[model samples]
Target chain A: MIIAMASGKGGTGKTTLSVNLAKAFSQPVQLLDCDVEEPNDHLFLGGELLNETIVSVLVPEVDASRCDGCRACSAFCRYNAIIVPGKTALVFPELCHSCGGCIKVCPQNALKEVEQRIGLIRTWRSGGISLLQGQLDVGVASAPPLIRVLKERIEPDRIVILDAPPGTSCPVVTTLRGADLALLVTEPTPFGLHDLTIAVEMVREINLPMAVIVNRMGIGDDRVQRFCQAENIPVIAEIMDDRRIAENYSRGLAAIDHVPGFRAVMIELRDKITALCRKEA
Target chain B: MKIAFSTSGSNLDAPLDSRFGRCASFLIYDLETDQFEIISNLQNLTAAQGAGIQAAETVVRSGAQALITGHCGPKAFKVLSAAGVTVYNAAEGTVHAALNAYKAGQLPPTSSADVEGHWS
Candidate 1:
């Protein structure tokens, strides 16, 4: 079973929930952090680096020595990444999608593909859980491709937990595509409810089974609870507003480790998720 | 000289599109012949990213010697500048007004990109 943790707005506790879930599972769980922009699961679950792999995207490289600049490559590139100006082709790797249309249409054969490093995927093991996270290089615009590379490493047999990025953009959709269940974490405030509505709609649009996890449960109003009830979505769990829990989180310690009896809560959440998945199956 | 202006309509009287990358259309005006043509920029107008760069390349490919638009991002500015295409700030009102402003030397050539990336 694959479970994805997501939040429409940042700082809503997606990472906190994901880390605790991985810890609660007695079976070997594969936790893949798809939030390449800011992966923080490693901080919560400290472990020795088992392996590291460089992730690169194929970007076009122009061979200036070629005889002619027919402008074919430039015209064919929908991205406008290849520019043939004054008898030479200039390639902007950042804009390239690696579609290879420019290379295929180039009559002069002036374009070649080259690997450009965009991010790194590292693997770690802590206790019974195996962690994989993608760290995208700063300034890289294309993250879906790197997220795809990270998803490819998912072990199907084990219970895989994915920590998805915030928002309802392409990256979030990419992470949610094949998820068995999506656990949306949100606060109890008006801003949380507003974004949660969009997030719920996004998940429903993609036709995925999802449940809500209201973090900082008592800080804001009960509007999120009412909205969830009206929408007929289940509230799987709630992490109460506790100052000590926040302090523990800031120190890179999981709630299971710091707060008394929090491990029991996480274990209960794990069982609930497993039961739900079993019911679906 | 051939010049391009980002526009909201197909004709010279069309309103000037404030966005350079995600404009509705581009009006390529030929100063010598006193004629102009319009090309739909619909493809890049909804681009997920790099709309500015794509639009700049489109103007450059149209064989325009200069461009007039409301804003140009850093990447697009570099591409147009390297291709020797002069870029000027967009004029108020219609495309024709911008052309007149260009002819009267009322429009100043931009020394650098007026806006950052993803302005639109």
Candidate 2:
């Protein structure tokens, strides 16, 4: 079962809930951190790295040795990534979307594909969980390519848990698009409610089965619970804002480790998710 | 004679307005008869992601002779350039006004100093 954990706004406890629940699972699992931009699940899990590989995207590179000044390659290019002068061509790598049409239509074999490193995908193994984390190189604006790399690394059949990026944006949707079930981890606050609404709208648009896990539940009002109940979005679990728990968390301890009793709650959460997936079928 | 207009959206029903990156449509105008007619935007492969690259690609793929948009990232400008699409910088306003300005050749097709980030 591929379970995805997502939150609309950042820092709404998506990682916190994901790490704890993943740790609680007794069965072998693989945790995927799809938040390529800012991955923090590793900080919580402290897993040992197994392997890491740089992921790059192919961009067209124009060779200057060609004879003719004809601009067929440039003419065929729809993305303006190449500018062919009389005897040569200039290529802006970032603009090239790797659509080989430029090469296919080029009169001269001046255009060649070159790789540009965009990000890295690392695999880690912990107690019982195998972690897949994608880290985008700083200054790289794109995340889709990296996301593809991470998702492609999914194991054959395992209880995969994906820690998705925040917001209802492109990266979030791309990561959660194929999720069996998305766990919307949230806090009970006005900001949380507002963003949760957006998240809900996005998930509903995609028609995914989802439930909410409220962290720091007692700190806020019942508005969150009320909204979830009204929308028929089940509030799967509630985590109180316990000072001891927070302190333990700061030391890189999982909530389940500090409070072993919460494992049962996660078990129930897992059961509820499995039931939802079964219903989906 | 075809010209693609840079848009924030990928279609006619595409909402076009914003800080260019988030703009709705990249109105592709055909320069047939020395006038402009818009062609379709590039397919929105990223209905899941924002209309950033898809809109830019629409402007690039429409294969229009010229592109009209409010603003553009250097990355997009490069893509459009490679696609043989001449980009014109226009201000955000009614679509008709922008189109007319393009017909009169009043829009600036050259990138401003601010537009050129690393290269002067």
Candidate 3:
């Protein structure tokens, strides 16, 4: 079964829960960190490097010799990536969506697709878990393509856990696609509840089964729990606000190994996720 | 010579629109014929992105030799420069006044974009 861990707000413990849960699972697990912008799961794993793969996206390259400045390519591009000013076409690779519509529409056949390096996917092994994470190149505006490439490395036989990026944008949706369940990690504050509501709506729009895991459960009011109860969404697990867990996290230590009672919490959470996945299946 | 002025209204009497990319309209005036026409920029005004590049394409395709606006962005400036179209910084007044200033050679030609891209 594939479980995607996501959060509407940043620093809400998506990474924390994902690493701990992966460590708690008894069988071998495949953890994919789909947060290409800033992947930090490797910091906690401290594993040996397995392999690296370069991820690239196709962008348009204009041929100045065969171009007659017909403006057809520019007219067909929705992103305005290609423009014909005078007698040749100019391509802004960063703006190109890699749709290849401009090449199809080019009457002069001046546009060609070329690969541009967008990011890197690195695989590592820590104990029974194999972690693959994508790190997007700086200044790249898009992250979904890299995340898609990372998700393709998911091992079908092993239990997979996807650590998705924050928010309900395209990147998160890309990670959540084709997952058995979406495990939304959030806090108990009003801010968490507000963004969590938006995230729930997004998940519902995609028709995905979802459950909530409330982290830092001691400080804020029970509004998040109440909201989940009202919405018929299950609050599967709650990790209390503990300074020791925070300290272990700061030291790049997995809560399952360092914290005293965190192992039981992760075990229970893993069992609940397994049950939910079974029900979903 | 034909010159384009980014304007808030359709006529030459209207004030110059400071924003070049998302301007309301463009007033194209011919120096020799003393005739002018207004091109609505509504399509680019509501564009999600690349408004500056598209707006520059509009000016270049109009066969205008010069563009008069309050500020230009890097992309738009690059397009205009590639098309050999001179960009003149317009004064804070009506299109008619900017036209007079251009005719008098009072408005200076910009070497580069004064404002960054996506400046609203």
Candidate 4:
């Protein structure tokens, strides 16, 4: 089963639950950290890197001498990011979509496409799990490109768990979409509850079935549980605020490795996911 | 030359208009006949989550010089670059709009992928 572990906010143990769940599954599993901006799954698993690939973007460089005063390029652009004066055309590097429609329009053959490196993809294998991660170059701001690279390395045979980035925006949606089941990881504080609602709504809007896993369960009030019960969304697994687990987490260890019950809970979680997938199928 | 518009569904049925805020779906157009042929998406393999790379490889394999799409991230942009396909950004409107824009020579020739997670 393909499961996406996502939360609305950061620092909600989304990665912790996702990696642990992958290890707990009785069968072979693959864990992918789709949070390209700050992937921590590898930090937790600490496996050897198998392969590295550079992901690139398409950009246009106009040959001024060949460029005619034709406005075909501008007319094709939906972003309104380019400016072509009577004699010359200028492109805003940031807004270009790399569609190559402009090149087709140029009668003079003035535009030559070029590539710019965006990020790196690393594939690694843990004991029973193969990890794929996208690490955006230090200065790059976009996760979409890196996320694309990581997704390319997915293997379907094993149970795949995606550690999705927080929020319900395009990146998170891109990472979480098409999963067999989505496990929404949230905490118990008021802040966690508020963001959880947003994430839940986003998933429902996508028409994907999802459940909730409240990490650090006991510290916050019972409001999260109340909300879940009211919505009829099952609380799959609850992890309390344990000092030992927290310490292990800070040192990049999966909670199941340090906690006694997390491994068993993950096994149960795996069963729940499989049952859900069968029902949907 | 035969042109293939990179598309997300094999049969042009799975990807509909408006649900994903997309226009006539992602496609490749034949400049010779001015006809649009939607390239089938290989991302359905279950292993590949996003087919940007696969799509680019497919486009490269097709030998299409110029391509069009609404939005593409940086990684796919690189694959297309290796294949020598020029790219344009922000063309999500109707296919007619894209063609007209191309005819008018208003669209920029190409763009690099960098749509999400800007970090200074």
Model 3 misplacement above 4 A: none
Candidate 4 structure quality by residue, lDDT tens digits, A40-150: 889888788899888888877879898875767766765433445335556655556667788787788888788878788888888888888888877665577668667
User: What's model 3's lDDT at A116?
Assistant: 98
Segments of candidate 2 deviating more than 4 angstroms: A67-80, A84-87, B1-120
Candidate 3 lDDT over residue span B8-107, tens digit each: 8998789999999999989999999999999888899788788989999999989999999999999899899999999998768999999999989899
Worst 10 residues of 4 chain A by lDDT: A79-88
Off by over 4 Å in 4: B1-120
Candidate 4 or 2, higher lDDT: 2
Q: What is the interface RMSD of each candidate, in Å?
A: 2.1, 7.4, 0.7, 12.3
Worst 10-residue lDDT window for candidate 3 chain A reads A89-98
True contacts kept of each: 0.24, 0.03, 0.59, 0.00
Off by over 4 Å in 1: A65-76, A83-88, B5-18, B23-44, B89-112
What are the per-residue Cα lDDT tens digits for candidate 2 across A1-281? 88889989788878877787788778988898999999878888888999999999988776778626476776666665665422466666666667788777877787778899989999888899988999999988778778977998787478889999999988888888888888898889999998999999999988888989888877878888999999999887887777766776788877777775677776777777778777875
Candidate 4 residue-wise lDDT at A36: 86
The lDDT values for all models are 0.89, 0.73, 0.92, 0.71
* lDDT digits (tens) for residues B2-120 of candidate 1: 99999989998899988888999999999999999998899986776767777887898899989998888888888888788999997568998999998999999998999888765
**Shift of residue A118 alpha carbon in model 1, Å:** 0.7
Choose the strongest candidate by DockQ: 3
